[model samples]
Target: MKYSSKNAQETEKLGKKLVSKLRGGETIALTGDLGSGKTVFAKGVAKALGIRKKITSPTFVLWRLYQIPKPGRIKYLCHIDLYRLTQSQDILALGINEYWQRKDTVCLIEWAEKIKRFLPRKNLFLVKFEISDLNTRKIIIDGVSDVRS
Candidate 1:
């Protein structure tokens, strides 16, 4: 579905709503330009997942893992940033496929266009963002998942 947000806050709210529907073993592919608010949207997802720690763009680190505490459970959220990688082999070396195989983790990949070939056809959520104005963004979300507001 398509969602329009007047500002980053609105975009994040949309992200949070989408996150509430997510289960473990899900993958979300995010594609957008620089400063398109992909990281802001991700912070919303983290919050929805009961993560209280600070969230930041993993540009320099490439990947960051967050643990969320739920009732009688712990959920793993792996956030990956592929902005600086120059080769697909770099991604492969990170053992991303291992995380993909796990049924107890959710992976959110930024700059997913860089590694599209490695992603599974099914069980993937694609979120694309475009800057419509100085403070507005047109976000398009596509997948077969149900997201409740």
Candidate 2:
């Protein structure tokens, strides 16, 4: 489905909408340009997941793991950023692939195009973001209904 966010707040609201639908072992591939509100959307999802820590893009750290606490659909959130790595080997070296193998974790990846070849073809949500205007973002979500365990 397609969604339009007039500002960062709206973008986060869209992200929040996806949280309840996530089950463990789900991977989310997010693609967008520099200022496309990808992080904002992620923050929204984190908020809905009952995470209290500040959400930041894991560009420098490469990846960040958050516990979803108790009474949630998923136990963990593996947020990854592949923008810094150009080689697939580097991605593999960081053990990034291991996140998808966990049955109790939900992963959200930014700059997912960088590791497109490494992403799973099934049970994934591909989110594409476009800067439609100075303050508006066009978000497209695919494969949501097709997500399987």
Candidate 3:
């Protein structure tokens, strides 16, 4: 657990304080690189799952679900982007393990080490961005221990 984000609106306010301690079938794997904010931390976890539209970077439409408006424990947020999918059979022909084994869903996988063997090491969560200069941003978050400020 680490964080730095001196920009992109403090990495979307640390992705809305890490989605208020998410409560859903989480996945969140996101590594970093190109532009390094990862859709501004997925538009702060799609504005804390209320998702007011406009949260781009499915990187040419690889994924993008975002629903969340019911009696919620998070209805959906998918948002995957494996940097244009070279193949892992195109991430299993785009099912993505049925949005990371949906249980009201909350996926969020940017490059995700390019589908690191199709994730799922049991609940999984790995953030890792590191630019640390042009508007800083170090963020680590492996198991996440309240991700200090």
Candidate 4:
């Protein structure tokens, strides 16, 4: 599916709406340029998961885990940033595989093209972002079809 966002807010809403159909154990692979709306979309996902603190790109720390407050199907949200890493082996060295595909967790990876082949295909949602213009983003989604408007 292809989605166009006029601004960051629209991109974020699209992310929130998409997650509404996700039960758990899903991996979202986000790919795009530095100023793309990847992190903005993630913020929407976090909000939908009931996390209100705030989420930022984990470019330095590598990854950040957000604990969902609940008795829900998803207990944790693993936000991974692969911007600093160049290969899948680096991801393995950090033991990122342990976090993905967990029954009680949802994994969202930024710069995911770096490790796309290593992710579980059956449950991975590939989201590619293309910056159309200032404040406008074109997003292409593959793998899932339940995203609502």
Q: Which structure among the candidates has the greatest TM-score? A: 4
Worst lDDT 10-window in candidate 4: 91-100
Q: Write the per-residue lDDT of candidate 1 for residues 79-149, one digit (tens) a residue.
A: 99899988966888776666763677788988988988987777689999899889999888888453544
Candidate 3 — what's its lDDT? Answer: 0.81
User: In candidate 2, which residue pairs clash?
Assistant: none
Q: Pick by lDDT: which candidate is best?
A: 4
Total backbone clashes of candidate 1, pairs 3 or more residues apart or in separate chains? 0
TM-score of model 3 vs. true structure: 0.32
lDDT of 4 by residue, 45-105 (tens): 9998988878999988899999998639998999999999976778878766677799889
Q: Please provide, for model 2 over 1-81, each residue's C-alpha lDDT reduced to its tens digit, 9 standing for 90 to 100.
A: 888789999889888888767877889899999999889989998898888999998888899999886745588888898
lDDT of 3 by residue, 73-143 (tens): 77888898889888756887786677675777889889889878878886677898989789998988786
Once model 2 is optimally superposed onto the true structure by TM-score, how far is the C-alpha of residue 93 displaced, in angstroms? 0.9
* Candidate 3 ranges with C-alpha deviation above 4 Å: 1-9, 12-14, 17-35, 39-84, 93-95, 100-103, 111-133, 136-149
The 10 consecutive residues of candidate 3 with the worst lDDT sum are: 140-149
All-Cα superposition RMSD per candidate: 1.8, 3.0, 13.0, 1.2
Ranking, TM-score, top scorer first: 4, 2, 1, 3
Better of 3 and 4 by lDDT: 4
Clash pairs, candidate 3, are none
Error of 3 at 134 (Å): 1.3
Given candidate 3, what's the lDDT at residue 80? 86
Residue-pair clashes per candidate: 0, 0, 0, 0
